[model samples]
Every structure is written in C-alpha cells, then in structure tokens.
Target: MRPSLGRFGYPKSVRGYAVQAPGAPTLDVFSRRTKWLQKERAARDAETSRKVDYVRDEVAARLCERLLDIKRHFPHVLDLGANACNIARILTRPNPDSYSAAPVYEPLSSRVSALTAAESSRSLLHRDEDLPFNNEIAITRHLLASDETLPFAPHTFDAVLSSCSLHWVNDLPSVLTQVNNILKPDAPFMAAMLGGDSLFELRTSLQLAEMERRGGIGIHMSPLADVRDVGGLLQRAGFRLLTVDVDDIVVDYPDSFALMADLQAMGESNALAGRDVPPIRRDVLVAADAIYRALHGNDDGTLPATFRLIYMIGWKEAPQQAKPLERGSGMVSIKDVLEGQRTGGKSGNR
Candidate 1:
C-alpha cells in the first residue's frame, strides 16, 4: 500500500518501507538516522539523569539480571540502536573474570557521529552490518519500532534482548518476522517495549490543546504500541512460552515545558514517519507551552506524567516447541499462565 498523510496531515509510511530482502533501501534509512540521534544522545542522557532518578535507582537495575542470564548462554553480545551507549556501559562493568564478556552497540549512524564529537569517549561502535557477530546473542533496545523492514534472516540468533524500543515501530508482524528469523529455535528473545498505556497524560493534554486550538484538527500524537499485542505477535511469529509483564513509572514534571524539553532532547518529538528534519516552529512556542500546562497542570502545581514499560522474557536457545495445543483443550487461565509472577519474578513490587 502507498503511504498516506495521517491524522495530523503528516506523511505516514515512507516509500518502499518494510525491508523485503537483504541489502535493500530500507536499510539505508535506518543507517542514515544514526548521525542525528548521536547529537541528541548526550542531551537525552542528561535529561533522563535529572528527572528519572527513581527509574535508575530501582526499576532499570533489574535489566542487569536479565542480561546476565543471556550472557551465560552467549558471552559475546550486540546491542542495536544504542542511544548514548548507556545500557552497555551499565552491564559490562566491574567484570574481571575469564569470561571476557562484552556487548557491542550498533547505534544509528547519526548517533555514531555524535559519539564521534566525543572522540574515544564513546560507548557505541560505528558499524551497521546484517549481523555483527556469528553465533552470538544480539540484543536491540527499541530499534524495531521504526522500520517496516529488517536486515536479518529467520532463526539466525542464539538469543535476543529488546527493551523499551518496539513501540516506535510501524509494521508489527513484519518486524516480528525479522526478529523470529534471527533467533535460534526455542532460543529466548527477551525484550521490553512501550505498551498502549504509556505517556497518558502528555498524549491527552497535547491532543486536547491541538483540537481546541485548530478547531478539531491537530497533529497526530505518537501512538503507544500495545504490549498485549506482543503476545499475539509472538504466537504468530511461532514463539512459545511467551510471558509479558507490565510496569508503570510516573514521572512528574515541574511543568509541561520541562517535559517537552526532555522529549526534544530525546529526538522523540516527531510523530511524522517520513520526516528527515527536526520540526521547526516559527511562531511563539511559549504560548503552546502555556496551553499545555493549563490543560495538564496539577493541584500541587506539578504535572503527573505516567509512562508504562513492559518487560518480556522468552527463551530462544531451545530447539523445539513443547507441543501443539489440541483443538479446544481449553484456553489456559491467567493464573496458570502467570505462575512465575511471584517475588523476584518478572513482576517486581515497589
């Protein structure tokens, strides 16, 4: 299907999106964005550092345990779309063992360039290949949500780890195909992506102001891809024993402008798919900030912004499906399926 202008009058999918074969043009677009994301990486790290301390002190640390298990299976690993190379630096530290474990980050070319601005001080390496290493674990965070196509074959990876990245992607099924192809049979492809309930306050406020200001027409709000959808996606992708857990983090902002600044710092401001330029506003942005604050402001003069993050853990290194479900054997109950969701399970308490 041809790409169309979406609700905000911005172009939706680009021409020839969704990579159908190896060495396709879709690969070019994904590689090209690295230069831009690199510039913003520094700013984004700083913003998240300032406002998201709780996530750092608690929620984010649990990822280390997950990566440790993947490390045990495959000592060498690769991280794609490594913004600021933040995740790698956290996990690959303080290890003085003979295991010689290291994880590579394939950030977008733009982000790679930005890391260059720092010279040898960069965590992400500058490389975009079909596969970084042979017979190894390849993990990507939030890289799948943007592209309609991928540069991988089926069942190619030993293990895969994706965290907080897939919501930005467009074609769910096709992306899943690429993901499944690279993962070895019964090999767990554990990942965390944005769910349908993320950024509720920001999305609602921005939408209301846009409609009010423009007479029922406004720019499109970036859609939060669903976590529950991942279950079906995994089933169709032929993944088994899939487990998905949802978690929420409420990030409070001093005001709406502070939130907007952080998002801009993260290069997440644009909802337009074909946009190759940073969105420029020629008019007074302060007024728009004012309108946003007015609509989303709080009683204590603080805005409550909620971001939902889902954590998924599945094993891919296994070589076969357990077995097929007999027709109408009765769907599994929620309690039976979520048997592992106890203390220190995928779901952790506050």
Candidate 2:
C-alpha cells in the first residue's frame, strides 16, 4: 500500500521486542532495540583507523554515476543515514586515490552543502571528524538523528542520498515518506540498501544447525527488503520516474567464520528485536560450520558470500517533467503484432 504524504506522525515507540498483528506481511516486521545496533556501528567506526567503508564507497560510486547520468548538480544535498560522511567525501574530495576515485565530477564540496548523521553527532567521523574537507571549505554538516525521526524542516534539500544504511531502520516507509516531503520539487533521491539475498549461505547453515540441535531456529540475521518491493515503495513515497536496480557482489572468504567476523566488524551483524534464543552453543557453531562447508564451499577452499545492493533512484514530482501515457492510448495492438510475426515465420519456412 502507498504511504500517505499527509500523515505527520512518527511510528509508535515500543519497549523491547514487539510483533505486528498476526496477518501482517513479514516486511512490516519491527525491531525494538535498534539503539544497540546504532551503538555497535558507532563503535566499529570509532575503532578503525581508515574505516573499512567498502559498502559506503560502493554506494558513493553508484551515486556518482547517477549524478553523471542526470547531468544536474544539486547545490543542497542531504545524505540520509550518512555514516562517516563517506558519500560527502566521495562527492567532495579532491585528488582521491585511484582505488576510490571516479570521473572528474563537479566539485560538490564547493557548490553543494549537505547534512549527514551517525548514531550520534559525536560519533559521526573517524580521526578527522573535527577537520574540514580541506583548509578552505566546510565538510558536510554532521548531526545526531535517527532514521525514525528526522529533525529537519520541509522542503529543505535539493537532493537526498543514502548508502547501505536505510535497511536497518525499523520504520522504513515512514522515514522514506518524511524524506519525500522534505525534498524540494524535482529534486533527485537515491539510496542503496541490503537486499533479501544477502548472507544466504550463512543463514541457511545456521538455521539447519539450530533446528538439528535445539529443535528451532532463532533470528540470526536482520530481515532484508526484497528488490521487487522497493520500486513500489518509491511510488508509495510519492516519487516519480523511479528506477530500482540490484547489484550482486560476491566476496570469497576463507570460511563462514571469517565472513561472520567481517559482518560483525562492519556492524552488519544481526540486531533483530524479535530474536528469542540465547547465544548459540559451541556444538551448534561446529555443526553450522560443517553444514556450510558441505553446501557452499569452493574447490579453492574459499567460501562465497553474497551482498545484494539494491539501488533506487527517483525524482520528486514536478509539473515540467513528462508523465506516463494514459491507459488504452497505445497505438499498436499486441495480437496483430504476434500474428504478423507468426505469418512471417511461416513464409520463411516456405
């Protein structure tokens, strides 16, 4: 169902884990304790010297492509859930290393102003948090804000972009609808979120191991949004000319343990509020490891883990932009076209 722009209230707060109504779709699932998730992410960022922000880097690269394709420079950009201001650095950094560089795009640092947020304002950046982009210009403004509640005014930005972060929000549609309302007319919006297929092998192995040992599988991974549902979400949030695409990135790991470690380091580990089980037993871990190796191990001894990044781009509706054609206005008939193709095939056979 489409989210209404007229709705102004945020989601109701609940203590601990809370489940929706019995018949509600699984996508509407809730997480009651995202505070720990936020803290975990902040702690991860704080520990790293350079911040191994691969997902954020990938997100910035894709947003750069969108900037190139649209041929528009947004003077006032907002980086939603902008962890460490990575997108800001990508869009602004001069003479970035080849490993993370894009085409010589416009200098967003000079022209575009942005607001970014971490779990808290203090935890936004690494070592260079206080330092500006360079000596001359200011970096993206960092704030303390949660996805469920944005502390900004309406029509505040020309563009809104996020990377690998929105998937963790408990009330995604509400956050998105708020984003829609705050963007100026004709503004560009893009985001990348983790998709449903991420960590398939690990999820499978864990479930199998848990069921065998404890007669049930507890939540071990966060629920991910399906790529199929995102386009509809953009429309529901009142976006136009929406485009949604998925990029599947497979990384080879020495084993499932290494993959899990990386996930923990990246603060992408399970933080589901509905998880009812206690910490997994050592036997369960060994069994899951064996199961993973049997089911998805590589000949070279490296296991593969998939990270599906679903990228969505849309525009705030504008009066000047073109709209889709009305139903029944098409000039061609499908039946006639099929018949013509059939006749042509028969003539070719003769």
Candidate 3:
C-alpha cells in the first residue's frame, strides 16, 4: 500500500525517516523541502522566472521532437516533474515556421490525447494552471506530487515525458522504477536532466575560491548523475531498449555573478542534504569571480557556462516488442564481408 502524504506534502514514511534512530544508515541525498522552497520562491517572481525558462523551453522542444519520431499515439501521457508546464506548452503550441519547412512533421498535441502535469511545488503547479495552454485539449489534469513518491497505479500512462527536472530527486533509481511501473507495456519514457559536467565552471570557481579564502571547500553545487551511469540505472529500473546521449548548451553571461543570479531564478540552486554550512563569504565570491574570468572567460568579455543535458529513452517491456537475436544465430561472417568489400569483388557467383 502507498503511504499517505504527511505535512509539507511529503509521504509519512519520509518524515518518519527524519527522526529515525541515530547512527542509522540512509539513502537520502537531497533535502526535498529545500528544493520545494527554491522552486516556490522562483515561481513568486514572474518576470525573472520566465527569463530562466529558455533552457527548459529548448529542452522541452527537443524532447517533443523525439516523441514525434515515434509513430505511436499516446492516449494518456504523464508529464513527470512538470515545471511550469514546459512540456505541455511545447506539445500544445503549433510552430507554423517549422511546419512550413517540414510538412511531414505532425503537431505533438495531435499525437497526445491527454496529458497530466505533475509537479512537486504547489506554487509552481498553481502557476502552471494559470498558463493559457491549460484550456487546450492536451493538458487534462494537474497533480501536486513529488518525484520521490509517485502516487499512481501501475500501467496507468501510455507514455511519460519529463524536461529539465529529475536531477533534484533524492532517489533517482526509485523514481525511474515508478515511471516504468506507471507506463503501459511497450510505452516509451523520454526525459532530459542536467548531467555531471553541467556547470563545471561555477563549481570549479567556487571550490578554488573557498579553498584559498577559508583554507577548505564545501559542497556549493548539487551533484548530478553521470552520463556513463544513466543507461545502467535505466536497465536496473527494468526499462528496455535504453538509449542515452548528452548535449551541451552553453550560455554566455557577463560574469559569474550574473550566472549565479540566473541559476537562482531558475530554481537550480544547491539543495544537497546537510547543506547547513554558511553561505560563501563576500570576499570569497569576489575572488571566485576573478578566478572564473581568468580561467573560462570568453574573448568577448563574457563567461561561458555549459549545461550538459543527458537525454534518455527507454520502453516498458512487452511480449510483442522486438528482441535481439541470439549471439551465434548470425549466418553471415563479418570477416568475409569485410574482405569482400576490401577486394571490391563479388562473393559466391564470382
């Protein structure tokens, strides 16, 4: 049975863990409350919030493009970790410019019969409800739920899509399992998250500054999943035909301070567990700014911050799905095929 939500919208079991016996082992890596607060604060400022949404919008469009490639219609889709309805907006809005270039492209809304946008922050979810697309036929429901604990029955959704979220989850493997569980058999799960190399410039600058100023360093940036391990995580979660790839989006800022401000507005600030350390001293921040410019400043008097987005596609297994042939079943020999090609000669007849 699923645990009921306790105060602050977390499962009762999660709150219980907070008071567990001392010295007990735990798997939690992020403070859910902190993340929720960050997102809520970001939503409160409408103008600044929209500014940082460009990244999410770009990623959402790319994810929707991948869905268009598959020739299947999703009767019901779940937008897990839906932040301000990025995926929903992309799916519902028609891009006449792109349609003119490629008439073969079909609108994502036509393919998606219905959508449920689920987000952890109530403020953000409420903000999503205010979007004009909610009146469209695509978005059918808005759910307030955490990615850590998905409240849904098995085989509920025909497909699942997430954009610019999931990296903040404390237990990613568990969440992926829930995603696979809710997806109907043979349904595809498409998502994109920040990879380990994301924001390396900021991370490095902060580390060096802290070390020089305080004689030590602290975790100023949240750790992210490495692309190398994403496929394994998907397979472990029972997702089949896994596809994983990475893309880097570099945005130039006037300096590190401006970049940090954007990150805060984007609700991408650090929310690591036990992150109670004092904020970076002003002197340290100044030193870090200098170091950042010296190390990675562009020739145009700006700094380049790279966000590496890791894209993953996996499918729920079904009996009808195609499977790889047995290893020794191949009749053709690669050695002979290569030799024939090298000689530019015919085989049996010649």
Candidate 4:
C-alpha cells in the first residue's frame, strides 16, 4: 500500500505520529515514501543487508560506548530510527573487544532498564525482531514509526539514542525538538548521523562526469548536515550541555560500481524529493568510475569512500541540572592569570 500525502506532501502515515509544533518549518527535502521503499527493498535480501550494515554497526558501537560513559541508570530508552536494531544488538550483546579496558564484559543493557526500537520501515524492523536476544537483560519493543515524527508522550523516556538515521530526516530541527520533548528532564540524547563532506569523492566524481558528458550535473548525493550547525540545532531544541564532534570512516571498494551497489543495499541511495531526473546515463557511470579511480584510488588499486559521521550529545533541561556561574562571578580575572604566566609568574608592574 502506498503512503498517503499530508501537509507539505509528508506521508499521511506520519500525521498521527506527532503534531508539528507551531512555527517549525517543514522542509520537503526528502521523500519519505521513497526512503521507505529503499529500506524495504534493501531488507528484502538478508545477506546483502547484513553485508552493507558494517558502517551502521560501527556507528552504533561508538554511540553505545559514549552512552556507557555516563554513570547513571536509564529506566527507559528510545532507539529512534532503529534500522535493523543495530543499537539494540550492541547494547544487548556488546563486543568484549570494544571494552577490553574494563575488568569484565558488562552488557550495556545492564544499565538500560528497557528499550523501544522504532523504525520507519516495517520490513527492516521485522528482520531483527526475532533475533535471540537475552530478554532478561535487554527488554526491547519494536515499533514501526517515522523518525521525522516521533510517536511518544512527553517525558516518556530516560534517554534517546539514534545511529546513522537522522541524516535522512527532512525536518531535523523539528525532530530534535520532539526527541527533547519525549526525553525526561536532564536525560541524555546521543546520536550519530552522516554529514559534512560524506561521500565527497563520489559526489565530485559524479558531478564532473555529468558535466563532462551532459554539460550539466544532477543531485547525486543527499545533502548532509554540517558539524558546525549541529550544536546550534541542539540548543534551539531546548537541549543543554551540548557536545558535537565528527569522525571519518573510510571503506575500500574495488570500484565505483561496487560502492554504489553497497549504498543501495544499505538503503542509503538518493531519495531526494523531485529527483525524477532521468536515470544516469551509462556513459556517465563509465566516466565517473574512471574519474573516481584517477582521483581517489588507493595504492592497491582499490577505491576509498569516506563516510563522515557527526556525533552529537545533548541533555534535556532540568531545574536541578548543573548550570554555569553568573557572568563576571569569577574571583580572578583571566587576563591577569594569562599575563602572569606570560611573564613567568612576575608582576607586570615589576
């Protein structure tokens, strides 16, 4: 069944998910129906889906690692856009190698009381629903829902986590606000999304190839978030104590065809709205492959594709949360301390 359209042409299925707060701009940059179809198609072949989940797995592990650093227990958590349950799997059966520094293998589920895995694609969600998880440790519930419109009550969760899913969201700021609203006061929200020059090599190669062949370019890659703007978004969403950082994960492929194929399997193919442009000409693909090799090929004849991941952490505002001291409350002037250090602890008057 096809998803009906709502305001700004969003999927009608998402209307009941949540009401968009007033004044929150609904950007129609992505086609939710197309995204769902892509994910559903990707999940059709289990083996191919698993093969392309390496990037998601890595990001989930890293996100969980950060979550583990917090020395607090989360009674309930939400895994937003939980494709294939990557975060759930990591939390339930954490790899001992990832935490070898610890004295023992402690499951992240031990700290999280319960988790809800919400996904936009039903096929992808069901693929992992039957996985043999230790239910006594990890109590997970699956929900088919859109990340663009979170269907949850206010202050419903102790924490919210997402891995490599927010990038596909059309109205990111609105979704972030929903995430903050659903999280309890002072609860943590941790997530990672592809952004900031991700797939630059392929993007550049495709543009150049199209320009050379067709004398024009098409939108080949989806636009991603910039790391610099993420902090501001968190603050705008009413989140405090924000932290944002980036990491690059490069994977080697035999050629551009292999890379594109893997991306399709990963359910990350371009789903930009109004992308009804004609299929890329075969000649352009040929030229793009050649250009890709010439530009970013490795010494061993393999091509390297970079996925830039932006990791962000923010906490819901709470009255009891720690706050910075009032302005000018410092006893010592920073300038004086810097000058003293510059003068080797000697007074400037001397």
Candidate 1 lDDT over residue span 252-344, tens digit each: 788776776666554445454554544434232444556556776777788776778777765543545575578778555556446646433
Q: Per-residue alpha-carbon lDDT of model 3 for 1-350, expressed as tens digits?
A: 87788889888764334476653354788888899899999988877888888899888987888887688888999999888888888887675235357665445788888888888877776676676777765675555666678888999999999998889887787889999999999999999999879999989998999999899998899899999989999999999988999999999999899999999998889999898888888999999999999999999889999999999999999999987789999888887788888899666822
lDDT of candidate model 3 versus the reference: 0.86
lDDT of 3 at 295: 91
lDDT of 1: 0.50
What would the TM-scores of all predictions be?
A: 0.59, 0.78, 0.86, 0.86
Q: Could you give candidate 4's per-residue lDDT for residues 122-202 as a string of tens digits?
A: 888777666677353555556655657887899999999999899999988899999999999999999999999999999
RMSD list, candidates in order: 13.5, 10.3, 10.0, 9.8
Question: What overall lDDT goes with each candidate model?
Answer: 0.50, 0.71, 0.86, 0.88
Better of 1 and 2 by TM-score: 2
To one decimal, what is the Cα RMSD in angstroms of model 2 from the true structure?
10.3
Clashes of each: 32, 0, 0, 0
Q: What shift in Å separates residue 317 of candidate 3 from its native position after superposition?
A: 0.7
Residue 15: error of model 1 in Å?
30
Give candidate 2 misplaced runs (Cα > 4 Å). 1-51, 93-121, 124-137, 331-350
User: How accurate locally is residue 291 in candidate 3, as Cα lDDT from 0 to 100?
Assistant: 91
Candidate 4 or 1, higher TM-score: 4
- TM-score attained by model 2: 0.78
